[model samples]
Every structure is written in C-alpha cells, then in structure tokens.
Target chain A: MIDWIESVLHITVQMGTLYLLASLGEIYAERSGILNLGLEGMMIMGAALSFIFTLAYGHFAAIIISIAAGILMSLVLAVMAIHMRLNQVVAGLAITMLGLGLSGFLAFPDIRKNILLSLNPALPEQALMTQEAPKLPEISIPLLSNIPIIGRAFFHHNVLVYVSYIAALVMWFILFKTRIGLSLRSVGEDPATADSLGVNVFLVRYLATVISGGFAGLAGAYLFIGFHPFWQEGMTAGKGFIALALVILSTWNPLRAVLGAYLFGGIDTVQYRLQLFGLGAQSPYFLAMLPYLITIITLILISFENLRKRIGVPKSLGIPYSREQD
Target chain B: MSRKINTPFGVIRIERRAAYPRHIAVLTTLLAVLLAFLAVAIILVLIGIDFTAAFTLIVESFTKPELMLNSVKQAIPICLSALGLGIAFKMNFWNIGAEGQIYVGMIASTGVVLLHAYYGLFDEHVLLPLMFLTSFALGGLWCLLPAFLKAKMNVNEILTTLMLNYVAILLVDYLIHGPWRDPGGYGFPLSIKFPDYAKLLFLFGDTAYTGLLMAILGAAAAYLIMDHSKLGFEIKVVGQNLNVARYSGIDVSKVIMFGAFIAGGLAGIGGLSIVSGIIGRLRPRASPGYGYTAIIVAALAGLNPWLIVLASIFFGGLLTAGDVLQASMNIPKTVIQMMQAIIFLFILMGEVFKRYRIVFEGKSGGDMP
Candidate 1:
C-alpha cells in the first residue's frame, strides 16, 4: 500500500508539473487574445532541441538554449499573425506544421537509433536503491514534512515542481492584480479602444506570444531533461494541444489552470495504474484518449454564449486586429 | 471644372483608372507560387545544395513511368478529398475533419472486407460495391457529428474536427493492434491481405488507373454540381454571408450539412481507394497525411473543383519528387512539407495584398525612396 501510494504521488508530481508549465504559458497567450495553437509544435521543437543540445552539452545549458530557440521560432508566428494581420488560428497551425516538420527532419537520426543518454542519480549518500530512471532531488520542508497529506503533496517535490507552482502564482498575480495586466486585458478586449488609449497593442501581443513561447519551451525542456530523460519521435505528443484546451477549460485563470492540469495528470496516472492492474489490453489506449475526450466534452458543454456572458473569452481571440480597420 | 484626359484612342479621351477584375486573383495566386519557389530556392542554397540540380531532379522524377503512375495514384485520393473540401470552402464551411472521415472510411472498408472474407462473400461479384457503399456511409456519418455540433450546438468545428482525428487514429490503432491483427501474420501490426475480388481493379495493366478514373469522375461531377446547379448557388450564398443566405430563403443549416456530407463522402472514397488499390491491407499509418495535404491543394487551387484536379496533380508530382529527393539527394522528406508551408503563407499573404492596398503618406516632400 505504501509503495503504491508513493508511485501515485510520483506520477502525479511529474505529470502535473510538466502540464502546469505548458498550460500557464498558454494561459498568458490566450488571455492576451492570441490563440497560440502552435503550442504543440513549439513544445515539440523545444523537446527536440533540448534533447539534441543536452546530448551535446549538459542539461542546464540545453534548457537555456531551447528556451531561446522557442522564443525565436515564435517570433515567426508573431510576424505573420500580429504584424501582418493574418488569421491567428491558421498561422498557429502553420507554425505547428513547420515546427513538426523541422523537428522531425532534424531529430530523425537520433530517434531511429533511440540514443538516449541517461542522467546520473543525484545524492550518492542516500541508501535507497537507485532505479534506471534518474531521481529528481526533493526538498523537504523542516516542520511541514511531519504533516500528513498536504505536506507530502506540496512540500516534498522536485525543484521544477516548486518553480512551476511559484511561476503560476506569480503569473496569476501579474495578470489579475497589476496595471500591465489591465492594459493587456484591455488590448485583448478591444484592441482599437486600447490603441486609442495609447496602448501599444501590437507590441503587447508580440510580447505575450514570445513569453508564451518561452514557457512552452521550458515545458518541453522539462519533458526531456526534467521528466522522461529521453527522446522519441513526436515525443510531445498532443500534450501541447491539450494544454491549449486547458487554458479555455480553466477560463484563462492561472489557478484553475493548475487544477485542470492536476486533474488531467490524475486521469493519466489512474489510467496507467488501471493498466498495471490488468483491466484489459485496450484499456491503455482508451485511457490515453480520456483527456482529449474530456476536453471535447467540456468544450461542447462550455458553450460560447455562456463563456461570453460569464467567463468572457478575449473579444478578439483568433481574429487578427488591424489598427487601420477602425 | 472637369478636364478631359487624352488617351491612345484617336479622338475619344477619358480620365480613368483600370478596374481590378476578379481574374486578378488568379494572377496573384501565380505570383504567390513564384515567390514560394524563390523562397524554396534560397533555402536550398542556404542548406548547401545546388538549387538548379535539386529542382531538375524534382522535375525529372515526373517523367519516369513508374513515378508518373505513382503521382497519379497518390493524386487520386487527394483530388477526391479536395473536391469535397473545395465545395465546403466555397460554401465557407471549414470542414477540417476530412482526415478523420477518411480514417472512418478506411475502417469501414476494412470491416466490410473482413466480413466478406469471413463469410466467403468475396466470391460474389457484388462485394466491391458493397464495400464502397459501407465505407462512404461510415465516412459520411463521421462527418455528421461535427456538422450537427456546429450547426446545432454552435461549437467550433475546427477544434472538434481536429480532436476527432486523434480519436479516429487511436480507434484504428486499437483495432489494428488487437482484434484486427491477422492471425497468420507473425506479430506484424497489419491485417490480412485483402482478396482480389474485394480489390479495385485497374483500368489499365497493373496500374491504379481505376482509382484515378474515379477521382476524375468525382472532380467532374463536383464541377457540374457546383457550377450548373441551384444547390451550388445556395452554397455560394451561404458561404458569402449566412444572413444574406437566410434572407434569400435558403436553409443555411441544410446547405452546411449537405456540403459536409459530400465532403466526408468523397474523403471516404479516397480512404477506400487507398486500402483496396495501394496498401491492400490495413496498417496503422494508412494515410500519408493526404487529408491535411488536401487543404493546401484546395486553397492553392482557389477552391474550384476543376482547378483542384490540376492542383492535386501538381502536389502529387511534388510528393513523388519528395520521395526521389529523399532517396537520391539525401534531402529530408520534410523539405516538401516546408515547401507546402511556404506556399500556404505566400498564398494567404498574396490574397491579403490583392484585397487591400497599402499606401504610405509622406509628411514632407521627399523622393519615392
């Protein structure tokens, strides 16, 4: 029972942290009125770059470089969707296809060979048996570690998990409680109105996209060096897209984004556990599809009319705003 | 006071600016294609390849008999899908789920073939038509979901359609890996080889020419329907503006549903063609991303059914050349994808410029620089 509990906790932490990182970036972009559907493509590019660079250099430097590459690639999307006033959704889709193609081409050789370099286990002093998977270092809070459930969930996690939580909190605060957030929201709500009020709408959209790209890149890096420590073709899978949907499901709220991520992470973890318990051979495939299926159902349930009245999506989301139009 | 401007005509003179006719859209498309080619050439040069040699290699692949046949064979499915897509786009309905519909068609066709084989129904002459009908019905039904959701529930078709593609893929994956796995095959993730009676026979000797003929028929039929029919007029109206369409007493929902059904049905035929004519067995990667590629073809062709036929052939040739480039020049197959992306960007940008002119206002007297 204790072992099972430990494994569940481990899976939840890893998946939740990865998703939180990606979805938070997505939250910012969508909140700014640019539906960056290219998140999946961006994440894939990040994964491939980080994996390749980590194999060449060390993990930390690869993380930094991958983030930079992601930001650079996102600028291409911004140039077309923001500056040129092209359709945001199509531009995002094109960016995804471009990223997927480029990454597949560059990473084909590595993927075919399955040449994954394993990370060394941290803390040689620990007496527990080391598994093949590299163990992330955990920080135990002095007094909080003694508490029962909440203590294990919050206090004892890898540095990435803590960083992701802090990032989400900081993002929530900045987006809701700050003057810049107000301006960004105004731009999203009514770009022409914002522009009339002297807000640089174009600049804000571009910045939001780049920062979103940065976060997506960090998520990709976390997937490789931080989570799995391996490389595979189409490694990011559809997680990036799910993150985009989560942004909507969360109603662009960073806190809800975390909750949504954990919910999905929990579903993913339970699916694996069900497979381990031998539900059926096809159970895993069905489980793999749960999150996407839930997203579709949730999307249908969350009608645009309801969202418009209450949660209120960006008025100009996915529509390219031209200053000259008004 | 009005002033008369002199013209090339002997006596009659008029001050006039040339009107931008609808045909200018075609010219803009051509210019976009040219720009895309130039961009591809520059990228080739940056990647340390001789652009002339690479392009020549691509062009030469089209002349070989086998490669030429392959190009047509590949174009057949894409052309059919594009026909449906063109109709939908003309009606301004973005039916992006052709990929999923195609998968559904493949599954339905495979199921029919399997059932026939199990029951010894392949010995009968009616098996082929039965398989085709089943596939088309399945494909059409798959499309009905999103169409219903969009027309009724007002859900975004793009996201729903895309998500459905993943679901269809997974469903197929489960079947191929589990129940549909051929007992005779030793651990191969493929179904049994389909019987000859269940297959689509070639019109010519040992070629997928029958599929090509069907595609041509489909394109021609779509052209006739879209151009000569009242239904086509309603589609055009609905696509241009739904409120206008409603005001004109056209049932907008029915038009959308009809368009989607036809689109999904055509994609279904494409799937059936693939299983019966090419692979002859079900596999996980049954499609080579043809459904998505059809979007590019349809857009590049300006959503005209007849033009889609020509565009599909061009894209088919590109796919053939991409394979050749992969084999001989050691270029990644993704270069073709990159070219497609570049073309889409250029075409979209060209459309923007064609619609709207940008004028720079000078604050002071300065040269045109």
Candidate 2:
C-alpha cells in the first residue's frame, strides 16, 4: 500500500510540476494585466520544436530552443494584446490556432509524393516523423536520496522538475518581494494608477507576457522530455487552459500557483489511480472526467465573491489599459 | 483603453473614431484578405513552391464536383455552430465549450435513435422531429448549468464552459466505448448506425442541405430576434453595458441565461445535424473540431448571420483547398489552420486600426529632447 501510494505521489509531483511551470508564467502575465490564453498554443509549439531540436541537438539545447519558440509565440500575444491593443481573447485564441496548426503541418507525411510537382519534405520535417525522443536526464540529491519515502517521492526528480521548483521560488520572490514585482502587480491591479506612478505599463506588460511565455515553454519541454519523453500533436492537450484556471485558483500568487497546480495534479493523478483500484475494474474515461468535474466545482467555489476577494484577484486583469483616457 | 504617443520624428496620435465609412470598412477588410494572400505567397516562395502551381491546384480542386459538394456539406455544421456562437459572443458570454455542447447534441439525438430502435418506437416522420427537439433541449440543458453558475455565483463562464466541454466529450466517449458500442462492429468504439427514421429530410442537393437550411433559418431568426425583438434589445443592452442594462430594469442574469441557452441549443442543433446528416453514427470522435472552428467563423463574420453563411462557405472552401494542397503540394491540410489564424490576427489588427486612425504630427518646437 505504501509503495502504491509513493508511486502515485511521485507521478502527482511530475504532473504538478508541468502545470506549475505553466501557471507560474500565467501569474506573471495576469499580474501585468494581460490574460494570455495562448499558453496551450505556445506550449505545443515548444513541444513540437523541442522534439525536432532534440533530434538534431542534445536535450539542453532542445529545451532552450523550445523556450525560444514559446517566447516567440508569446510575443505574438503581446503584440496583439498590448501594442496593438486588440481583443486579448481573440488574439490569444488565434495564437493557439496558429501554434497547433504550424506544428501539425510541419510534421505531415513525407509530402514528396510521386507527381509532376511534388513538394519535398524538409529534412527536419522528415526527422519529426521518424525520430525517437531521448529521455531527459534525472538527478537525485546526494544525502536527500537516502531519505526513503519522502526523498523518493519528491527529492528524486529530473533536472527540469527541479528547474520548475526553482523557477516557482524565483517567480514567487520576484512577484512578492521585488520592486519589479510590485510594479507588475500594480499594473495588473490598476494600470492607470501604476502608469501615473511612473511605472512603464506597456514595458512591464510586455516583459511579463514574454517571461511567462518562456516559463510555459519550459513546461512544455519538461512534459516532452522529463515526463512523457514523447511528442504528439496537441500533446499540450488543454493543459495551457488548465494553467489559466490555476492562476485564478491561486489568486495570481506564484507560490500558490505551485500549490494550485499540485492540487489539480492530485485530482488528475487520483483519477488515473482510481482506474487501477477495485482490481482495475473502473473505466478510465470515467476517471478522465474527474479532473474536469473537479475543475468546474473549484471554479464555482472560487467565483463566489468571498473566495475571489480573499485571493486578491487583480482588479484590472484582462482589461486593456488606455493611459491617455485615464 | 485609448492612447496617443509622441515619437522622436513625429507625434503619432491615436484617437478612436466614432464611426468609419461603410465602404472603408469593406475596403480595409478586403485589403487585409489580400495582404494575407500576399503573405501566403511570400511563404510559398520562401518554401520553394511555385504560386502558379498552387493556385492551379486550388482552382482545379474546386472544379471537382465531389470536392465542391464536400466543402458545402462540411460548411453546414460549421455555419450552424458559428451562428450559435455569434449570439453568445454578442452577449459577451464566452461559450468555449460549443465543442462539448456539440457532443451532447449528438449524444441526445443518438440516444433517441437507440431508444426508438429498442422499444419499436416512433415512425421515421415522427422520430425525425423528436430527434431534433430532443437534441436542441439537451444541448441547451448542457449549456444552462454553466450559465446558471455564471449568473448566480459570478463564475467565470470561459473556464466552466471549457471544463464542461471535456466532461461532455468524455461522457460521449464513455458511452460509445461501453454500452453504446455496436456489438456487431467488431468492438469498434461506435454506436449503431442511426436509423433512416432518425435522419433529416433533404431540401435540395444532398441531405446535408438540411443542415445548411437549418443554419440559414437559425441565422435569420437570430437576425430578427437581435434586430427586431425586445429580448434582443435586452441582450444588446446587457452586453453593451451591464450597469446601464440594470438601470434600465433588465434582469441581467435572466438575459444572460436566455442567450446562453439559445447558444447551446443552436450548437446542439449543429451537433444533431452532424450525426443525422453527415456521419450517421455516434462515433467516438464525431466532430472534426467544427464547434471550435465556428468561433473563428463567427468572429471573422463580425457576428453578422448573413456574413456568417458566406464566411462558413469560405472556410469550407479553405478546408477543401487544404486537402487539395496536401495532395498536390504534399503539405498537410492542417496548414489551413495556420492560415486562418494568421488571417484572424490580421483581422484583429485591422479592427484596431479601423477603430482608431493614426495621425502623425510634427514634433513640438520645445521638445524635451
């Protein structure tokens, strides 16, 4: 029983880290008053890019490339939502559509069919179809590895997993303790006020969105290399959207983003675990529904005005700011 | 938010226009489309593709009668879904789970068909209407839960509706994989083929025309209700400004619920048409993301029902062209999604520029510099 429990906990942490990385990024973007809904799109691009890059370069370089792809995707969101002052929802949705479509199209069956005007598949495109993903390296702390259950469950994880934790801590400090953090929060809560106080609202928003996009990209790379070690089209599979909910659940707090991600991860893990219980008799589809069901229930609970206020949701979040009018 | 900024060379002032000329709006939209094609052309050239060849491939694909029929047929459910989406979008209700609503509609219609077969129930003529109504009601029921939560608890409908989409999809998946699975189909995750009685009536061309007709009817109804009815005015008022709508003594929650319910109902009809008119079976994955695509169509059409039909058909052609491109150019049809996204991004950018004209002013004499 303990062994079974330990395995689930370990898997839970892995999944939790995936969502944590994404949500932590979202927390920053939302803090800067930009609701980027393209996390899934960006993450998928990261995954697809990492898969191709990993085939060509080593794992670390692939991760970097993936992060760059993520940053690039987020820039699109920033340009639309901040610079152009377009509808964030529409722009974000378009980014997602573009990312998913671009990745999928890039890896289609060798297009060079026997015909008069057959388009040859690019080398990377061909490789995407026939490449085996190399697993990300795992690292176990020296003394911590000897701590038995807790160590095995938490201490021992991949480099990316540890990076997620470190990222969360760094993000938490930046968001809570630092001057830049304050500026970001102020920008999100009241951009007009923030702008009046000489905070470059536009710059802060752009930085926040780009940084968050970087984090989401790392999460995608982690999922592909550390967690699953494989890539599929749309493998980000609404995790981006789930991360969006996690930001609200955590009230835009980076540390809380980690906790909220784990809670969601627990729901996902337990659902999968449930399918194994009762001697493996339960339907996995029913199990799959549990996370979504819990998400709805959680959304309902948090939106009750009481919890929402307690969590300190940014007042100006998701609303475009016009400095001149204010 | 509106803003004006001073640059080094000139002061570029951005001011919102109360309204622009209709011709300019049309002209700008056309220009944007043309720009997108130009961008595509540049991409094609960079990728070593001849534009002439690609154009011929597209035109040739359209000439094929089967492809044209398929494109129109495919456009039907998407148009229906888009019309439904337009109503909710106008009301500021983000019904992201039209995908799930579509599933519920399919499930509801499929259930009726299965039950009819099991109990030796209604005749074809009698059952067809029943299927339509059942699917509509069930779809509305599915959507109502989220709207109810949104109204009562101020719940974020985007997240709730999105989450529900997965639940609805899984429910259908579970049903199809379990009890609903056709025993005679060698364990394929699919329900039995829908009976002919449960099928829709054809108005013209293929029976798929029923779906197109339904979409047209829904769009017309939405146009009338939005432009000519009190409910439409209420929804518009609520959408435009919640405070003003409340001041006008409107039940904001009630208005939200009505629009939302209808949105789901229309999407459900789209789902019903897919099963009854297109697929003819409750398969594991019935929709090819038509519900999601409908959102794009609605936005592209600027929420106009008449324009939605044209946009839907245009998208349908694009989708068909994607396939043709895949066959000829060896590119995946999924590239169309990227093209559509680029077009939408341009649309949003165009909308921003349209709403606010940019004017350059010479730098002031005593500039800080």
Listed for each candidate, the true contacts retained, as a fraction, are: 0.38, 0.82
Docking class of 1: acceptable
lDDT, candidate 2, A219-282, per-residue tens: 8888887788665667887888888777777778888777887787887788777665643433
Per-residue lDDT, model 1, residue B303, is 84
DockQ values of all predictions: 0.30, 0.57
Error of 2 at B306 (Å): 0.5
lDDT of 1 by residue, B56-122 (tens): 9778767888888888888877888888888877876677777888888889889988887776655
Give the per-residue lDDT of model 1 (tens digit) for A95-177.
Answer: 77767766765565522122232233332322122112233457777788556655676677667777898999999999999
The interface RMSD values of the models, given in order, are: 4.9, 3.5
Best by lDDT: 2
Task: Give the docking tier of candidate 2.
Answer: medium
TM-score for each predicted model, relative to the true structure: 0.87, 0.92
**Candidate 2: clashing pairs of residues:** none
Candidate 2 interface RMS? 3.5
